[model samples]
Target: MKRLILVVYLLITLGCDKKYLEAKPDRNLLVPVHLEDFQAILDNTADMNNSTYLNFVGADDYLTTNSGYQSASYLMQNAYLWKADIYQNSQTGDPVGDWSSCYKQVFNANVVLDGIDKLGGTADAKLAGVKGTALFFRAMAYFNLAQLFCKAYTTQGAANDAGIPIRLTADVNPRPARGTLTDTYRQIISDLESSLVIIAGNSNFKSRPSKLAVRALLARVYLAMGNYEQALFYAEAVLAESNSLLDYNTINATLARPFPAALPNGNAEVLFYSAMPSLAFLTSQQNSIHPEIYNAYSENDLRKQVFFIDRGNGIINFKGHYTGNVLLFAGLAIDEIYLTKSECLERLGRGAEAIACLNQLLIKRMKTGTYVAQVSTGSNLQLILTERRKELLYRNLRWMDLKRLNLEEATALVLTRTVNGVSYKLVPNSGLWVLPIPDNELIAGAVEQNIR
Candidate 1:
């Protein structure tokens, strides 16, 4: 089956009797909004798994095979950052699939949100928890789509800088306009806060929505808003709850094997991972492990084994520590939670605490005793950012991460390994960074058109 995307609208069907308002919830109009459904949607919608959307939006997995190889979608995306050659067929008309798919996930969340209202007194703490999670996830989905479908998050973006389509209601036909980036983020923050009320008071789905997901989402949102202290506050919430880290030894013992056939979800470092799709040979797809990633890994570095493979063909060899179908690793992991905390803390001038969090995670991954505080102090922020990257590389964190940092910094750092053998540079916050509005949506007037 395709990704778990169901857009249902539970519009009130008017009737003569009061019993009509109390009609049993229809699965067609509403899906199960418990923890199970929340996790299911999250697991299914991961960027790594199969999505005609969501692929090759610059997480640095785009490695070329031989000289003549072509990956159009990825190439066009990379053109805004890193290395991708602009060829004739490189453009994919409109980027409706990405816009549609992300919104589809949001639509699913909205269905749950609406169902919560209809469920009314039938709702328990578990339902409340699910509602919060759905809100957070919907906010997250909109946040990502907005960043991907619109221009950079600049003060200038406050205008109708052409952000992603805003789908607030579960109604599939909710014809909304392209909200401003600021407006979109405001809505995302609103959803997250509302979600926090539901997620925080519940204990049933402790490991699912729990309070951690809300805090994590809060941290992410605050970071996006440039509010470091608030971000730090929430990220610390997650770090306090779990000491989750990607233990290298555990990965070696459990997850390290061959490519997809090996350990599906590589180390304990994995914070949140979706189901591994049953697609054949994952690493060799359009966005494969860049040869630079393989080359950069030290022979002694344990992570090198899980991420790279030495195929003698000299083409591009890969190893996906997490291959096949996805399993939910997104919300409940210690790695990302800690990383989020570390970044937030560092940005908030809590250098020692940030470094401590960073070291805690690094020591676990590297199996080292500890890191020196003095040495890890001056560049604590950079260290935190880089660790987040190293930990979450190719895990679909790059696009937003780049957007968060200085655009020129991104242009300087992104190194495209190959593109028709002629290396190209990314344009940081260029218009190309945002996906072209999907072709179908543009031509048929299905969705608002984005500039090419």
Candidate 2:
């Protein structure tokens, strides 16, 4: 029997009421009957895993080469230039795969959670772990979708702003309208909180969800939500579990690819392992690191040597991805947790503790004994944020950071891109920050598109 591929939207009868949408997985053929079967669905990295290629292109991390720019797909080119219409038309199909892929994960996760209760002889340990994992995956998918599809979560207008559709069941009922931003976050946080208690035990595999990974993800989500205290709490909780940083001094940075790729554990710093598809790897031959970002790295910083490959002629490619593959690491790592904790601490007025955290991470990133502890002062928030940007470059984060930072009166960022002698600028709080929902989805689901 063929596998049942669950989907977010269902095609309804024409002229039928829009509220009564319905879709069903293949009922007789591929329903998961056992623990292992559900686990297999969760383990399908190709479908269940998330990718950040479109977000990476939209972000300000790397610039495409002239040939790379011309050779890219229509969606890639448009996203690279931040055009209002990335999908072109309904006939063009989905502009990016992340949207569908993430929702598929959520569907599969719901399937697993629903089926687990029906299975007989499922041990207590198996039940707890599997249920916790399903919840974690669902929360993660929702969080990723919210970041891309919805506007930034502002305390003021979040109750009114449209969020991605929230699906908690595997049933055929599919009248899934976009909920308010506040409702979306409430669901995400609720899932994470529930999963945190269930996955309290540790897992040996970084790819698997565990208590620590939940904490890391919560830290990331809260940070995005601009809740500094909660972000710091979760970040430090993850740090408390394991706060190891890779010592760049120990690695041979001159190798063709400096980082080890095939390690079973992936990069030691990674708290949870998730990555963008390898197809989007930014090679020096293809994409160049923005000059300003690259120049900000001091000579003493080992990341300049280990994390980047100098392609002579002013072109540089990022090499320091935790996955050690072209797949940009879109997962949680200790370095990010430390940075998050540091930033939250600084923002919350624990400046000295924040500097200490930065110093700890920088000591490992910099050349042996060349690191200097930075001061914990008001002016240094920008410095801290700059370091955060540098540390997490090409990890599919800058777009959301730009959104939250733009909300601040002090750090409102106006971004500009110059392509082929034409200049494109994105003003702070521009609606372009929220990308359009793919046309086919908007039509099929009877949903409204984001305002340009």
Per-residue lDDT tens digits for candidate 1, residues 343-362, read: 77776667787777777766
Clashing residue pairs in candidate 2 (N, C-alpha, C atoms within 3 angstroms): none
Best candidate, lDDT: 2
RMSD of 2: 3.6
Model 2 regions lying over 4 Å from their true place: 1-26, 91-95, 120-123, 280-284
Candidate 2's residue-wise lDDT over 1-452, tens digit each? 13423321221121122334433335454456767777777766665555556777788887776778877777778888889988786444433477767767777788788888777423577877888888899999998888788888888988999998788876535648887999999999999998887764776676777898899999999999999999999998988879888889998898766666523575678777788875633443678888889999999998899888877877788887777766778887888999999899989988888888999988898888788878777656887899999999978888889889989989887777777778888888888888888776776675778998
Angstrom error of the Cα, residue 227, model 2: value is 0.7
Estimate the Cα RMSD of every predicted model relative to the unseen true structure.
7.0, 3.6
Clashes of each: 23, 0
Candidate with top TM-score is 2
